[model samples]
Target: MWWSLREKRRRKMSSTHLHSQRPKRTMAQKSMKNPRSRSRFSVKTSENYIERMPPEVILKILSYLDAGSLFCFGFVNKRFQELANNNAMWYRFYAGQQAKKKNPRLIDEVTDGLSVVGIQERPEGYWRKQFFKELAGYNANWKKKLKAIHLYTGLPSQTAQILRSLRVRWAVTLTDGKGRESTSEQTHVHFTDAAVTVSWSAGDWPFIDQLTVLKLHGVVRVPLQCPDEYKPGWKSLLTKVKLNKDVWKLCGSDRLVKLLYTEQGITVGVWQEQREIAFIMVNLHYHQLVERSLLGSCVVQYQPAEHTAAFDDVDPEYGLHGYAAHIELHSTAGSIASGRFSQLFCTKDQISDGHLQLKVISKSNRSQHAPLCGSISLPWRTDALQGQIEGCCMLTLTVFDEAQIPFWCVSAPVAMTTSEQAEVSYDCTGESFFVRYEDAEGKVEIELRWMEDHKQYFMVSLIIFLSISKVNKHFGRDYLPQ
Candidate 1:
């Protein structure tokens, strides 16, 4: 019995020791499976985490940000600072923003820290004040680039002088005042001041293709030289002569002897008059030639209907008669040969009667003295033809002495048609006026009522006015006082 009790006690002690050691073995295996867990357990328990990405991808992201944001982000790291200093990146940004609008101040700020590759920094207020000064110093080592210059009217002469000193191969001046000439390539200058004179030597200004002198003083003389290619010939000659007062006297040339008037000399107004004379000459010559060519071959046809008379009420004040003539060419031949001819002349009394006579000649005949067609006399009185025709066709009316020597002519092509009529009516008190018109085809009628206060007229027409007129009319009505 004593030996059995000892054996039972020993078995119970061994079983308790095995149970205590089992928990320790399981914990050891879990720690070995996860090293990270063991490290976290050894340190403190926290959720703070930091991730690192490639520097290149980060830079690309930064590039999309604006200059201000990119500037601030540059301090994020050394890599970013390098990117921020890149000239190309900043240049692209500067060009893009500048294209959208002008912002010189913003450009200055962005390029302040970076070293620009090909461009140099201009001094402060360079564009506003010292732009030309800087441009003048820049050597002409660069290729010629076409540039347009916008000059202000009120700029001081010194500024203009500085601009003239620049290496501008070609320049276009946009101002009302006179511009100084540059010793460079051809320059085209436009001005609103009509009285401004452009004085340049023909040889020096060889590049000048066109010179337009706008409304100028009646007495100002512009010295112009014909180009070498356009030297005097049988066609026309260039003569340098002084214009006394308003009269332009051909002093140095004997060619204009026939065109000379009394001591008053030939004025510019006379040249304008000659244009009309030339047209009348063309018409008279054409009609005369046609009559001579077709005289025996074809019978003469006439539109004998009496035309309504039209008159300018102010003609007497201007010492001009309201007389005119209309002639049409119905050519059997397809084309008229081109050649120079003498001036067209008419009897001094032809104005009162509205009579026209054409000098006829054959193509084979080249003499200035040619046989004439029978006189064309229209019996229509001034009052009978009122509002009967379209606007007057361009008629060259030449008045000469009985000897047929050309004296004075007026060419005013009236843009009138046979089927249309124009009538201008004035109020008795001269306070209001209106115009009525009928189209040549008689398909349309229009009436325009004058609004004296606004200095405008309202037209009732078949066509529509553009959108601008609608806005203008709306504003005009709104602004008119009740």
Candidate 2:
């Protein structure tokens, strides 16, 4: 009887388990939970590229960047900083910058007090010391590294504040003392300057290449793009630079100014106050850098632009010459005290060409400060004139101050290029001012405006030169004040 009862209970339990149905999942639960059981899908993405890339790959990539870029990159992230600062990496950079030799293994450059190696080994941190030494302006092998300096925009103290990095464009032409010339290499060194960017590079990579901007002190890297905020100001700064190309401002005797690049060579100027005091015009087409080179000796010191020979004749097609009439001097305006003036006339080619005669006129008349009357002439198109040519002419004038120092000088550029606009006919006269200076014909201009401001600075009567060449019949205009 007990056995029969157990069998019935077991049967009842088995039936219940076999026949019972499971409950259906709700829509919310089904949507929220994984569709498949034991799924390994994750919502997060893995983008740690540095962690993914092999260190050898990273190191091979950092070989192409400049030294300044490498140093700036040292602040990126711990990994990047470490990779950028690696001593081996600097060895490659120093090697690339080194002068070539007859033997691939032997080098003349004395880095870290050692010559080239032949299967020899060096301690770690050796290249790092060598890099810093190059920057310290040592290692005379690269002595021609920096030939000229240009003060582009701001003071050196303001470099970090205004620029993203101090982008140094350095090119050296190697030369031996015996006058042998060599084209070395080009280097663009960038450091923190506020105006542009506060970014750094891992030098330039050898193979892998892409522009990048890493977070300031963060590990996340972002695509480097120019800042929108600084673009307009940058454009304006460029315009300002273009306008004040004449000035070579001398700040101090011993210290050199900042550097700016030009197509021909380097120009040194102060960005603020619209000034440039000195410039070293080097024709790299013919010259090389060395301790005692002809080009190095002839650094173009800052003289009043017009007073100097108007030497920036970049194009043979266009030459600079201009004239002013209706002269006016205001005692309360700028730095012109009592002075004497003289003028010279020469054809475009004759100015630079040593063969032609520069028929200069002398005027030693002493003039008082106010209403300092004078007449000036620049030939319009002098085909009939015996000496003057049509294409261009250089009009040079000298102004001696009360102490006979050449205080005010003019070497105005006049365009006589035979275009339809370069008619023998002159522009309207008695406009109180006239100047045409451009690759093409344009009226009125800048260097003169700067000279006016210069006079205003000294709190003396500013000497005014008026241009009415049309009335003067293109020979010379008399000083007529409106």
Winning candidate number (lDDT): 2
lDDT of 1: 0.27
Taking the candidates one at a time, how many backbone clashes does each contain?
A: 14, 46
* Worst-scoring 10-residue span by lDDT in model 2: 231-240
Candidate 1: segments with Cα more than 4 A from true spot: 1-32, 35-51, 102-482
lDDT accuracy of residue 442 in candidate 1: 13
Q: Give per-model TM-scores.
A: 0.17, 0.26
lDDT string, candidate 2, 126-160, tens digits: 67666454433334433233332212211123322
Q: In candidate 1, what are the lDDT values of residues 82-200, reduced to their tens digit?
A: 55555444455555454344454555564435455343354322221222222223333221221212122111223222223432222112111233332221212211110011211
lDDT of 2: 0.30
**lDDT (C-alpha, whole model) for all candidates:** 0.27, 0.30
